[model samples]
Target chain A: MGIQLDFPAVLERWPSFLGGAALTLELAALATMFGALLGTLAAVGRGTHNALIAGACKVYVETIRNTPLLVQIFLVYFGLASLGLKFSAFTVAVAALTINVGAYTAEIMRAGFEAIPRGQIEAAEGLALSRVQIYWHIILLPAVERVYPALTSQFVLLMLASSVCSQISAEELTAIANYIQSDTYRAFETYIIVAVLYVILSLVMRAGFWGLGLVLFPRRRRLGTPL
Target chain B: MQQNTSSEPIVSLRDVQKSFGPLKVLDGVSFAVDRGEVLAIIGRSGSGKSTALRCIDRFEKVDGGEIMVCGHRVDRPDVDLRALRQDVGIVFQSYNLFPHLTIEQNITLAPCAVKKMATGQAKELARKVLAQVGLEEKLHAYPEQLSGGQQQRAAIARSLAMQPKVMLFDEVTSALDPELTGEVLKVIEQLAADGMTMVMVTHEMGFAKSIADRIVFMHRGKVHESGPASILTSPTTPELRQFVGTGNLKS
Candidate 1:
């Protein structure tokens, strides 16, 4: 017999679901901003002439990217606790997520940086632009523009992956769903709603990023194509 | 007329030598471009003409010998490259314009960043240089939007915005269509007439013969033959004979 479905129980908890989604967005937004900054610095560090700095950035990207996010979350949670330091679950989750996504963003940004034509850098050098000036104008900005799509996708994935923070009692969307499913004994119905909420969030994020791309990269917009 | 009142060469390479791994690109080549004089370097593809031009800008470090540009000893270990570049402008075969910026922005970037010019002044400078290159109307356009000839002109304008004492052109028109080449050459001719001290490695014998006050012919990484523009018409070496007498060597 096909079992009876009870979406009404989940729908009645719309406030809780919405609150959870809001918290998820908060975590994702913070992570995306800080992670982008950290990743860009790491990408630049990787390309620098100093061996020690490049090696350290390499280790960070490799270790973070290779390990699971769940393990990272637990490490940040309990590892801090064991060190006689304590932070809120929300803080721990954001720290974990930022650390995780920064690695991926770094790799994506590095590929973008490498894809820039050598002639571009040479031209800038020939013009007597300082090293930092060259990196900022000729290398970084155009590279970010060329790989905007890749960066957007990685950030969206990071948002979805924020669900794993539930294990650390982050109370994000997934944690709330876990609470509701167990409380109401409506696991199937609760999960379906959460899945739909995730889909909606991802779409909202993509649209927001697409609009940002239009503003930040006017050249690409004017050309109506990737540079 | 004495173009240079000081009678000192503005750009000089003294027995400069450079090698790329197993290949000797610039082998003890020496040349000097006096202030307000146009010097053309002509040679075949493998003759190291481009490398010699590059060394003057320190783009290629010479293995031996010295390079002096605008009073900066480029061969010195502590050579101030930025200072040297500020006084010397270079254009290349490829326009190498920053595609992300407008023509105006591309021309103003170095001046504003390096010279600390205010935005209003930089914009005015951009306008002046763009006018010099006959591209004042295309200032707001991105590089990709312009034709190859227009892009090269814009590149020249970008260099001119620095108001350099000396200009280096490394086959600046070699990549252009025959029809497009004339416009770029015309811009160079104007720069020469304006008394810009220039050292250009060129393949356009006709353009070189007309614009160059002196010509340095390179072969096997050495100055095989060099003299006034008249040398292009009457040569003294067999290489020069076979090059200009029978057929233009493109070398």
Candidate 2:
């Protein structure tokens, strides 16, 4: 039998799809902010001279990057519950996504940090800048500027990967699609609509990051120069 | 020259030694810089001239002996390094200005963050130093926006913003064009005339002959000759004569 087209049937569930799309975005924003903080800290930790701290951060980044995101979500959702720590599906989704993306962010940030020259740090030292001052002014801010594009792209991927959270019935767009398709008995139509929504969501995220890039790195925007 | 209460030597390295892995860069190097005096260190590449300056700022840890900067011993394991660095400023050949910051921000960062000065106060001080470097008009310019000379002057301004007791210049003008070199060298000469203590590692024979109070030549990580600039013009040592005779001394 030829595939029957029923986009209109799935179109009737637009409100549910819209709501699911909004929640996906909310989950992405929350994960991006928190994950960025966690990742930056991990990057600094990995670059430190202390072997123990560096080793631990290295292990965390490698372990997360090596494992599949599906297994990670399951582990985070069921593992936490098994430990008697109950969290809502949305909360678990955000938590799992944050943990997963934080590792990639760490590696990207570490590359940014390494790109800073040894001479710059020595110059900061010669100026009598304290360790904190040197790290913030010479290292951290410029590193962010150098790697902002990479960082933002990773966040967009994180938004797409958030679809995996549907496995736990997180009530995001994919989960909503599963619900609507079963109710309307139109799996192909529901999935196609949901897939289009994801593409729109990713585009929106890309635009948002581009705007943020303009704001955060005004030097680059105004002068057309890299920091 | 007579010494005043506040005019003690700003930098004194006694029996300093440094080694990287198995190779020794500086072996038992000792030198001193009197307050308000301009000292020039001349040496072939990798002869420890730059390494000696780095030791004064504790950028390179000394394996043995003591480095006293503004009366504080930096070689001690328990010293407050950050505080020590606040009194000694250094300029590099690459002009290592923070490329992300504007000239004004680059100059004011250490003062506001490390010295804990108020932001307004730091800005005022930065403006004054930028004016001193003739870069007051370029305060908002980034490093790449400026010419090589302007960037070096801005680097000098950044160090001067700290109001350091001593300044170390590691071939500050080497990276600039000949015409551009004059602008930076003029600023250094003005600082010397104003009685700022400075130790400069440079190949500029004219700068040394005209501005320096003492000239020291290093070879193979050792100070081969130490005397007045007149003596450097016609050095007693064979190594010093060869170094100054060849145009290699003029970066």
Candidates' TM-scores? 0.96, 0.96
In model 1, the runs with Cα more than 4 Å from the true position are B1-5, B249-251
- For candidate 2, write residues B1-251 as lDDT tens digits: 22345755788988888998888888888889988889999889999999999888888888999888887888988878878888888999999988888898998898888878999999899899999889899988889899999999999999988888889999999888899999999999888988889999998887888899998888888888998888676889898888888875443
Model 2: residues >4 Å from true position, as ranges? A1-3, B1-7, B248-251
Task: Give one digit per residue, the lDDT tens place, for model 1 in A58-114.
Answer: 999999988999999999999999999889999999999999999999999999999
lDDT for model 2 comes to 0.89
Candidate 1 chain A lDDT trough over 10 residues, lowest sum: A218-227
B169 Cα displacement, candidate 2 (Å): 0.1
C-alpha positional error of residue B129 in candidate 1 after TM-score superposition, expressed in Å: 1.0
Mind giving the per-residue lDDT tens digits that candidate 2 earns over A103-174? 999999999999999999988888777777788778987898899889999999999899899899997888
* DockQ agreement of candidate 1 with the native complex: 0.79
Worst 10 residues of 2 chain A by lDDT: A125-134
